[model samples]
Target: MPSLSPSSGQSGLSGRTPPSPSEALTVYVVDDEELIRTSLQGLLRSMQLDVRTFGSAEEFLAAPKVAGPACLVLDVRLRGESGLAFQQSLAHRGLAHLPVIIMTGHGDVAMTVQAMKAGARDFLEKPFRQQEMIDAVIGALEADTRRLAAERSLDELRSCWADLTPREREVLGHVAAGRMNKQIAGDMGIAEITAKIHRGQGMRKMRSRSVADLVLKMQALDVIRRAA
Candidate 1:
């Protein structure tokens, strides 16, 4: 896996600010057993990982969070909530993008299936090798980073779309739907030349380099709904 640390000299060369410690990847552990929590926390800290441990699902949920790439190392059984069920609850509350790795002492095939179906990124039985946990945690964090980046891109696409003029927006929709300039002008009750101008302006404002690119950006904004 790639290192989470910012590359050396990147900030110097690009004049961008370096990432702070709070932006480093974190591993959040939630297990009811005090010994287990401390032991795992010690292990992760030894690896230079930022680790936070909670005694229960409710406690973990209530804790203030850091904004960065992170994953939950969750044990299956808790004081008041089962990990699998809590996974479902996370999805219900729109926090499902948070990755979870389930660990348990009494896991079975059915439980494994349920956890996976409920959105667990990985599972490990108690007493597993340390390397296994480390690898799973790294993979889970990467998955979450990708999800967050996608959402950020979608938000930016929506913002750019919001800046289009009404006529430019209409021409964009037509072009995205594969309408020719002449056909778009006929349908929109404008001359072909005027339609061409609006189409060029829309493409520039949308920052799209091709019809395919424009289509994808607009799709991210659900512009098809407005076009329909």
Candidate 2:
């Protein structure tokens, strides 16, 4: 990933500057206070980051879904609906995968603990240092990137697995269970020679170069089971 730098020119309601051309991070700042929002926007932009400011949780929600690597820096307090409530709503709606950093003026140890439990990537007190905020943002973005990559890989694995024939799938299951060809043949009521052929074909279709590779792929797909 490339480093981010701050940019000049105040944009949005907060008057926060934009990110520098060199910065690659995209950050969304949500706070009801215009001053705090603008300050954060400027701070981040100076670091060469892409910053977007939202006046409320509703405004943030109204924005389109983020497409690339990004994180949300959300305030703990908001008018009408609380930030914690908004976070819960996102989780309930299956949007918890998006990384979030909770910022609170009235933050306490208990609140921080609760936010961590609720899947916040990090928690920042209102008077936090610039370095602290930058570190949290970088950490959150890195985590989001890794998570999105994992999800994509899992989807591709599922699609590939779905292309297998029933017999191939059965062979895969036995192989993942550590069964040898002779043992699999006995279990399936087939000769060892027939089992070997089926196993070879299944391995080829699954694109597994070795038994270890096949087993790892099955584990990644969550299809490998331990014997009771």
For candidate 1, the TM-score is 0.82
* Top lDDT hit: 1
Which ten residues in a row are the worst by lDDT in model 2?
1-10
Residues 147-209, candidate 2: write the lDDT tens digits: 767887788788878988887789778988889999999999989888888888888877888
On TM-score, the candidate that comes out on top is: 1
- Model 2 residue 107 distance off true place after TM-score fit, in angstroms: 1.7
TM-scores of all models?
0.82, 0.80
Q: Please, what is the whole-model Cα lDDT of each candidate in the order they appear?
A: 0.80, 0.78
Candidate 2: how many backbone clashes?
8
